[model samples]
Target: MNLKQFWQNFGEAAVYYPQLAQKMGGVSAAILYQILGRWLNQSSTVQCSLKEITDATGLSEAEQKLAREELKARSVLEFKLMRSQPEIYSYTLNFEQLEQLILNDSAVEKTSTVKRDPYFPPRRQPIAVSVTPHYQFSGPWRSQQQLEAFQDALLSYAKQQGYSNPGGWVFKIIDGISKGIKSPFWDEFIAEKPLGSSQKIQQEWEIEPGVPYPAFESERIQYYTHKGEPLESAVAKARSELRNPVKAKDLWEGFLRKCDRIANDALKAKKAGVETPYLPPSFSEQSTVTKASVMEKLSQLQGDSSLLEAENPPEKTLSEEEETSSDIPSLESLNNLYQSPITQNWVEEQIAKHPEWGYTIREGKVIDQYPF
Candidate 1:
């Protein structure tokens, strides 16, 4: 059927039949007319199924059935289900009855002679047109509980970071997630820092009295690495010293001087072929030393029992060690060690040494040890 021609005809008919237009002033009526109009240009009768109506109108099965029944009651359409296949139905457009109803409505409208102002024109009744319905899923993709939990986590994080308004950000994040957008940052942020605790320290440095401002990024990074402090702690320390501007300036100068001294000591140690306990200022500093020097230090540490003992001593006694061991590698190292035969043997030996612990390995990794 030519939909454009059918739509033009339908509009003209509505003008000629104001009552018919008024009767079709609802979504269901408009939908029914659209469906019937599609078949009218081709033939009076068309065979179809409920699914076809749903696909064409984007209405649910229940909505389509209700609309079909409404049209049937108004004597504008007729349909009968096939006896053999209940799903299939034959529809007939009752154009004769529709014309008759339109004429009757027009006659009734002409009989009502309502007076109008000379300057005011009569307003025509608006006809409802059916466009494609846009369906929005009401519930979230995830469960309500899970969504709420994530929102709470975001809110807590915002509060910790001193956000003036967190609801707006939380709403956007939740809305994005509802639309199937993944939030990996949310997962990582929640894992690294607890909800109520700030992950990054808030820092304010002072160039003048009572005029505190944020520290430079380079200075903040240097302070965090050199002091072996978390970003949040380093920032807090700097902020605390800002109350007294002169004292704060002195403290910063002292910190810079300490870094210079440490750097000089490390340089002298390198010349004397002595390994310094202090870490390099940055990875770039390590590159300044020869590869052979770095490897030689590693080789020496591997051979020297004293250094190894200082880092990780052998378990003294079961009474003292119990389930924990000073010699046990970190969780990160154990994860890597899980794939090694040597590490596996070492783990088995340790388990044998402490039979009371009832150590076990599952999926090629120790399962009985407490995971930190």
Candidate 2:
């Protein structure tokens, strides 16, 4: 057998059907195909023994048999067993059938938009629901009455922390504690405040000496007025600075620096006669832009007369054109047409078309052929 010829055939087959190795029983079948091609000699048929195939492909006897069965089932190979030795078979590669199957599979794959491997199961999507901070516990409380009571007490504790709605995080914390998931926060919270207790918990958990809870809305407004900063920016900066405990003096200093920069910018803009873009916090408190303003802006941008007309349209009345369109084939004209002999003949012809209707014309008058 010519090794070069065998390799050439193998490469050609691989190029023609790139997925063949995987689709047709994997590596062992691919190796066997190449070995058979080497012994093919200018003919489609190759005479090979089971031992020869096993030796060439390094597949066990069982694997070799399975590969042959898969190749035949795929219409890529056919073989005839010899009468003398069933183990030795005359094999023929159905090149035409193999090529056809490959083309058909390719066409099918191209038509499918969502490509997924047939070998593996599809993955499931995660369940998602909107959770709000202010949501109260509404429970059936059948077997979980204790959990519900604990949740109510947790909500009361959260309210003392200035959170109107303690949010989903509180529930997650409580759930973790109930499930025996250990955490320092859970340990301290539970130890300091027992379940169903309305009394204030002791201040065992202390904030650092000079650290303060973040600034309130009133303080944020005061900072915005003094600093000439955007109220949003001032609020965001204060929240960021006080997110974790820092020295109270340090937090105040950061706030002051931000205010100084903003105030200087405002002064510079005023000196240059450039109007400051930042609005006062009071202006921000006003109601949002009305729908009419939005519509006016859209009309201006689109430059559409129809949109403007639609916004403040006049009372509608039927125009001459609409009135003329409505007078389609007057009733008197339709009655005259119905009295004509041509109309009668056309109607009779239509009835004659359906023999199943059992209608017959006798002396120029129609009647049902079959009557119950």
Candidate 3:
């Protein structure tokens, strides 16, 4: 790549390291770009000694050392020595890999904090009722006298069991019954009476997050928050510092640097006949190639026969009038002319606007303008 292209690509790579950009400033960033870019251009891969980097940058010996250390600290480049000479060092960072690394790191940091208030707010009572309604009797008919007798038996049972309130007594009784015993064992035991053993019942219930217990009173409830929410929301909410959020940017950059490391390692692994440590990044055709460019490529490779074959009938030729009247369109024409349900309404509207054409609807269908 030319110096301009190198800078652009290098800039893409440097995006993985936010702190490095800040540390190097614009001028130093340009220099680092030259140093790394030159190394990549000279060798099939980038791996260089200190002197080679200096030679590439045209910086002094002292300046070369400083640059090496700075790049290493910022993880812009990694160092390796094939021989003792300063220029004998070999290794380079892949900018694309680094960019993805930064993205992943930022993703991780953002997804890791708790943000919601734990305290429960007061519950609003229904305005029309003026009182909390209880579950009314909805079962088979029972006379008022039968209901009164049942209530008395329940109340006496509660007093015998030393439960101060009916709610507590009912709670225990229901708990025992649900646990598979026909009688309330806790009440009988508390009352100093012995009853036959009952089978142990195991009931499994799943509590949905934030749902209050039906049998329990009070507004307070326990709930589980998604683990990723706390850090993710916190990182998003925190304001940028130093004209931008340097820490977040740095993490992102560091991630990119790691990506570069992975990419470079992959190249080395290919050379060494070892497996690459990571799968490299991929882009969709829509993302990397424009529609115009794609069409241009297809046009260059096109043949008249191939084009003819793509049409509905491969073997037939059109008559002069048929060819002249042919409304068949190219891919581009199809894309441009694509219409949806909304377009139907729009066309009807236009026809309605023209006084010469009277459009009417019969039932659900348009009554006029049938061309086919």
Candidate that would win on lDDT: 1
Off by over 4 Å in 1: 1-21, 114-372
Q: What value does the lDDT take at residue 303 in candidate 2?
A: 43
Q: Write the per-residue lDDT of candidate 1 for residues 1-372, one digit (tens) a residue.
A: 798987887443321234444665557665656666776656798887878766666678777777777778778888898999899988888778777877888888885777777798788879998776884323343555665676788897777768888898787776775577766545554466554343333333443434443333235456666778887777677565554557766766765676788778888888888775464434232233564455345525444323223234575687766544444433334334446553445445555665544455678766655544
TM-score of each: 0.25, 0.26, 0.21
* Whole-model Cα lDDT of every candidate shown, in order: 0.61, 0.60, 0.46
Among all windows of ten consecutive residues in candidate 1, which has the lowest summed lDDT? 303-312
Candidate 1 C-alpha error for residue 57, in Å = 0.8
Shift in Å, residue 77, candidate 2? 1.1
TM-score (C-alpha) between model 2 and the true structure: 0.26
Model 1 misses residue 179 by how many Å?
A: 71
**Shift of residue 85 alpha carbon in model 2, Å:** 3.5
